[model samples]
Target: MLLKNERISEIVDGKRVIVKKPELLAPAGNLEKLKIAVHYGADAVFIGGQEYSLRANADNFTIEEIREGVEFANQYGAKVYVTANIYAHNENIPGLDDYLRALEDAGVHGIIVADPLIIETARRVAPKLEVHLSTQQSLANWKAVQFWKEEGLERVVLAREVSAEEIRQIKEKVDIEIEAFIHGAMCSAYSGRCVLSNHMTARDSNRGGCCQSCRWDYDLYQLSDDGREIPLFSENDAPFAMSAKDLNLIRAIPAMIELGVDSLKIEGRMKSIHYVATVVSVYRKVIDAYCADPDHFTIREEWVRELDKCANRETASSFFEGFPDYTNHMYGTHSRKTTHEFAGLVLDYDRETGIATIQQRNHFKPGDEVEFFGPEIENFTQVIEKIWDEDGNELDAARHPLQIVKVPVKRPLFPYNMMRKEN
Candidate 1:
């Protein structure tokens, strides 16, 4: 599923000019991750609120947090989008109306919504906030995009099934902005409009309490005419037939930009802050590199290596070019591999002492090597030569989670920076 970026050019005043890079849109499950995503170079970040979004399991933002997040992102010239994309019943509208008004008052830049009623409600209750058609709408063609555009949506987050050619065609006919999922998880169903979780667990997937029923293992059984039950296989013997490979379109930046895609989205709202920082940072570099010098654009191996650290599933460019094959599905039990682990988070560093106060996440010994990375800083490597616990006691290793330790280092480290070790 690897896609190489092809050189795309157009004549402007009898001269060839390269296409511009699209806005990099990252996902944030909470306020902390939202700030991290923006600081890591995302031009915009999409987040789910406490209700009416698909990711109910995520640590979604509260009203106060939403206000703060919007203010924080605005300081950096970045935008915050609140997700109210859940399919709602009659019981949900009143609350949704209040929520949309609250968001508009909180200064949110846009609202990602799918239901027609929700969109119409946003227009009525919060007309100032831009409306983005969520992927849940399953918009796959120009007509659908036009339909949503006519419904007053400013942007359309297309379904994951769209191809480059389809995207180009849609842009050619549509006036609204186009967004595509360039990275992260792919739903077994179309844009996650599923009854599996609802029917299996009574936790409605459309209303946001998806139990990920598709990712669960199931055993098939048959009932014979003789009233005897025949087990096809045990749960352990069942395959992950519904699990699709995680999408990684790191190599498609040039082509995506050339297609006039208004936004490039990464889809992980329930993922870790480390995952947010790593994925956003990698894509940021790729996009910046291509935008800076399109003719010399080359997908760096370092970017791939960085992305692999946080990727849970094997990577693929699902449906970007055409229908994907068996390679796009992770059918086996052991299908994912993480190449790095979050070792610790740097809290603060003393310049004169050259000691970094770190909060350990995963265990790392005094002799272990780790890499530290943060906003506006090149990833610097440091060997843990000497370590001491906050109790002023020397330690052979930082053993427990959340253990505070001080390590002497030559390079200056900033607070909120992350440190990782090879897995």
Candidate 2:
């Protein structure tokens, strides 16, 4: 195995591009989002339990829900990793053993952790469970990597501060799997272990309940002529010091792959199901295409275009090169791009004719132009040329949610392809 795909930018047209088929690790903030991630092509997914997770704000799974989710993921041949990455008070450390026992019983493939004490606790309590070091550790050197490997950690989710070249160097020196944040939001703090939130609010990010005060708009004050801190004002009142844009690597997956990355991780613990589904699906198509045939990754421009629906700051190759000039972020932001509502996707279409059958999602009106994403095809335009309800009546458009509609597609459509329109 090549281990990872090359960055899509290095593609020379007509020249063969080799993809190493890196493991695509998507995020699952909730069960609904988990289903979509797995359905889209996630090799593995990471979700947080109800307690002791960095993303306490997310709709995390309950114990029973996690068990069901593990079974559901296994049915689709995807592995599930659970997060237990919280700094423990000395008083509560005694009870953590029970928590790991419960998690191991639930069939979680691995547990992501931060504190070294917790790693030691897990080895004693749940020795069979794999341990993935959370980025909170902020480990960048071979010493830390080797140390963790000695402690029996299987994977290290490296800090975003380290470049891909550093990871390549570390990989050469270490034996553990390196999972990097190929795409996602970034924290101004080192590996997201900042004291700013604790100083402002009582919540500590290391303790799992981060009141994301990082995203808060702040004013920079400096001692002025009078030796007093003064605030400057702009004509338009908006956050001027927020340096972080969302991290998006849609265009650079191939490059990250070339770095011998073991897994490409998408980071969004508080994301919505719609966001997870759209992103995971698009990346799934891109990775699968690259894996099945090297040429497929280059032929489709629509993959990145489809990403515009949930596109972040839109970056590529941030790992190998020095951190992009824009990498240092003050405020963690979200996707500004708005995708259409949960609309139907095309299941299949008759190649000989224009007839199409859609797996319904949301209702729509006549004359609505539905964007169709076909397998192997870059982009397609199809208007609601005609609508046939299941009743066989010619309707203007779907009026109810999940209402199946038969419409005419311009080109041949396939199973598992998607068709959606903005609501």
Candidate 3:
């Protein structure tokens, strides 16, 4: 059996060739999520610092936290990249040079940059730090990729609008490393260049304060000849829509691997730790399985099921197959529901006593059946027959968030193993 980090040999044309698997890149909104990403088999994790990040609302990392996260990921052979992808204004320019230097000193692998100002400053101030062009640049053509390559960018995150054929063409023409968004939310505008947030909520979508105005509902109205207002439709009709369905590309893993894309990125920096773990683990398995043997590769139903468990919105393979149609765009009310809910996280496990210590994430009572999963172990379902608090007192339910609890287990679990229950 082929394992991760091992290259596979394939016969292309009439010659045998060696193929290195693409890196699995995930997102981290905080230190805990960063650890969860690496623990679940991410090859690299991208995080946003406190400044110059589009995810301004996220609990971004401090320099010290970045250093700690780097150390944690390094132990698992994973890399850390910091995001400075916001389009900078005049006031955002000051102290950016210092921040770039600090990220380099903290041993970050690279910085995902969008603004010309930040890119130039990183090149000038921190020459050793690798610079990656963010997807915000919207480099959809091969010539744009060539331009960045000549300008000294190590990689380009292609715009989400780029189709599968476009990606293949870009790879054929440009020799620079290619990174593509494999799964996550899709931007309603062209590569997230929307002004709706700025016009409606006074929040700049480019410079980090996006209010997601595109996802909001607005009353549809029409004007009469007398200049009076009129309702466009009855209350039963769906609202005027602009939101796009979330991207799920599990079915396209084999094609992406064959296209020679260097990295497959998951786009959710502001998502929960449960989200990070679930999504990363699912992709990790899919990529490894396909790379193990290309000829016999088949998309597993369990992989799709695992992804569906964490999805908060409707999902579709957008833009990858071809130009998206009406099915790609979401209208009316979106059901932000999933098949499962994260119940707890494993803190410690005892083999002799068949007991496991867990930190509660959601409410669970005795007799509730929960499923435990991790990167190294097969998933198993167990019924909660008894629960004990940290003080060894019996508890009726694991209700309090982050509360420590003990439960009996049939299989051994390690730290970072997550448990979820059917919703």
Q: Against the true structure, whose lDDT is highest?
A: 3
RMSD values, in order shown: 4.1, 5.0, 3.6
lDDT of 3 by residue, 1-423 (tens): 122323446777755443768999999999999999999999999999999988989999999999999999999999999989998999998999899999999999999999989999999999888999999888889999999999999999999989899998888777888899999988877865787878988889998888877787777899999999998979897887778899989999888887888899999999988999999999999988887667777888988999888889998888889988889878786667889999999999999998999999999999999999999788889899999999999999999999999999999999999999999
lDDT of 1 by residue, 372-410 (tens): 888757888878898899988999999899999999978
Residue 159's lDDT within candidate 2 is: 82
Sort by lDDT, best first: 3, 1, 2
| Location of the lowest summed lDDT over 10 successive residues in candidate 3 | 1-10
Which TM-score value belongs to model 2?
Answer: 0.80
Clashing residue pairs, backbone N/CA/C < 3 A, model 2: 6-254, 6-255, 7-254, 7-255, 164-319, 244-329
Clashes of each: 0, 6, 0
Per-residue lDDT, model 3, residue 402, is: 98
Candidate 1 lands at a TM-score of 0.90
The per-residue C-alpha lDDT of model 1 at residue 358 equals 96
Give me the displacement of residue 328 in model 3, in angstroms. Answer: 0.9
| Candidate 3 off by > 4 Å | 1-18, 219-236
Q: What's model 1's overall lDDT?
A: 0.85
